[model samples]
Target: MKPPDARHSQAEDARLLTDQNELARQEALNGLRQFDAVVEMVEYHLQPEHRFRFRPSHLLHLHRLALEGISSYAGTWRPASIQIEGSRHQPAGAHRVPELIEELCDYVNDHWQECTPIHLAAYVMWRLNWIHPFTDGNGRTSRAASYLIPCLRAGYLLPGKQTIPDQISQNKKPYYEALEAADAAWSERGTVDLSAMENLLAELLARQLVEVLDHATGGHVTLPSAKENPSS
Candidate 1:
């Protein structure tokens, strides 16, 4: 069988790409595939007997799916230092990535029972982004894994038109601000504060569910608009 068009030839290895347009196209395609795979993963874990386990391997799988045709470092931890553009917080050194990721999974698994779904989801999102494990696709992988947490915790996939990650991707200013808020708390007092991120996810998740309800009822129910209350 012929390989998928997106994975054909030069697209098979992003390192060979020189044209900016091809790179952009491939990234977009990879992103779609990544999200589809994430949804599949969530569905698999939603089964009655299957339980979700937060692990470094899951993160790497998501990261690989996220950047399969965009970077050679797709699934592997970076071997050198990295920087987060437009952010003052310095990520852990490359050598520290493995340990940091392990700690992240440990935090989620350790707090799995005690924490609320939103809190756990927020922690996964913030801590994974804070770790910045890969050379690229960090945000995408983080969002995918975070979304998975809530779905697994609920024992079923969450209903939505636009996912929490899709909402955040559409408007990143608030997402970045929430991340910075968590970072500030962490840096100042060594706290794992994720209230800002929790609130953000709560709002987005509400909006997503509202959309589902609206779709189900054929738009008869007029819910308050998320657009009008941007500050809320």
Candidate 2:
């Protein structure tokens, strides 16, 4: 098999590409693979006798699984600075990644009870993006981490036909806006404000619950104009 095209490389690794069409195809396949992985991980954690502890290693492993075939630096932090295209936010310096990620893990584990599930999930998603730890697949990994938050907190995997990550992927504009809002709050006030992201996630989870319920009852339910309440 020929080496995958690297004409649109996004990182030092030539294997990471930015070709929209190819990237889209790879992402679709990767999303499915990651979905299965999330289910398995959630199930394993939910086992009656198992004790689940949130760890930075889980996020690293998720990143590895998410970009397994596309990026050579899938599970590793970037060795050089990265510029997020079209975003004003600058991620932490490469040298600070380990410390930052350790801090994130500590925050999540320590405050797991103080915060709501949506708040916790949104924080993970935004903080991961802000860190930009990996050379690639940071968004996917963060989104997966977001999903894992609620599951781990609930002590059971949440049921849904369309997960929060899937919803975020379908229409990223609002997701980006929410993340940007959180970023702005952090930059200006030196505080974490995840209200926007939490609201969006709450909406997505509600939609997922509705969809799952519809399927469970064998009913084709359609809500009011999706524009008024976009789920996808």
Candidate 3:
């Protein structure tokens, strides 16, 4: 390996950047704390036991429903009822739904050795959004599950931050655009390929993991990538 590309250089920056005093650490911890609770609710709703597990807008709607006490019956899946996309009222691709997530799980389960779980998770998320299965909240739901897998992986893979949107969030629209652009590519060609996706995903995760390492550790590297075979 040629070390990480520049896009993946956050770890090196982290090593240099995290020697701040207690005050800075406190500030960072505070931000992480707020973010933590938000993600927790998001991830819990992602579990299969949630009944609405694969429903596209379920996660996003659940967030508002849980925190704001918004009223609506739960787990109803219909094009108009559960929509998610840049444009409203547009039905997602045929593959966009809980099955897309299940397929991601299946892919990661079998190919952990061949691909980084973080990268695979990112790709899965990308596909989920493109499918645009729901009528309302696919982005938030995919975003939640994307974060959730790593949290689960951290519990199982290593001792690091459970979520990683910090880095991904640094450039939000670009991330969304990348995914949407890939979808556009698929629309033109009528196919999607995971390998083409991995390149973008690798850049996203290697950097995002480094950011998560900082975010969860009060700006220090408390939780490293515990993944046994992280490509890095």
Candidate 4:
């Protein structure tokens, strides 16, 4: 038999692991609740003749929602530089985030009519990921902001049992590849090349719409109800 101290240490380790897992689960639940709230707000702004203008504050608010229970830094820009893992791309310096975000908002507002909704949404997602404005939850915030673009520009929430954000999270390889492709193009030639990301977004949106059609035609998939929260 093992020594009593050894047995006690194993038990203590197990308890710590369990506690960590439970904390992760609770954090996920809270994030989902916040995502639902953000979705509701997006829908509200998309109402007829509401005239919503995309702004830096909107991104800040969405970031806050995405990390409501996970990080104290939610809804605020990072004060220190951040690095992306497993990628060659580097985000802007911490001090430049505020100005860059303002430029992003202004660019979107000015080009709202010039670009198609899908292109615009893709740009937002890619740029936010590139900016890495927050200390954590940047991807979540970016995806949420990306969803908001199509809804706001198209004047309604896109219907689906699964959203683009869900699809991106489920299969991140393609998403990351697309972002990296855009990054490479910009880094090499100083031009914003979002065609790859645009294609991915288009495919996801198409799949989402197809899912909606299937549900309407008696498919087995259940649509997200008003009370349904996003899965983190």
Q: List per-prediction Cα lDDT, in the order shown.
A: 0.81, 0.82, 0.47, 0.76
- Estimate, for each residue in 1-232, the C-alpha lDDT of model 2 and write its tens digit: 1221111114566477578898778877887888787888888878878766678788888888788777888778888887777677788778999999998888888897898989989989999989888887888899998899898888778888688888887888788888788888899899999999999999999998988878877776666875685555
Model 1 residue 67 lDDT score: 73
RMSD of 1: 8.6
Model 1: lDDT of residue 190: 100
Error of 4 at 195 (Å): 1.0
lDDT of 1 by residue, 88-133 (tens): 6788887999999998999899999999989999998988888777
TM-score of model 1 vs. true structure: 0.86
lDDT of residue 220 for candidate 2: 66
C-alpha TM-score for every candidate: 0.86, 0.84, 0.48, 0.82
33-141 per-residue lDDT for model 4 (tens digits)? 6568667877778776767788888888877776665556767888777777666777878899999998888878999999898888888988888888887777777
Q: lDDT value for candidate 4?
A: 0.76
Better of 1 and 4 by lDDT: 1
* Total clashing pairs for each candidate: 0, 0, 10, 0
The lowest-lDDT stretch of 10 consecutive residues in candidate 3 is 5-14
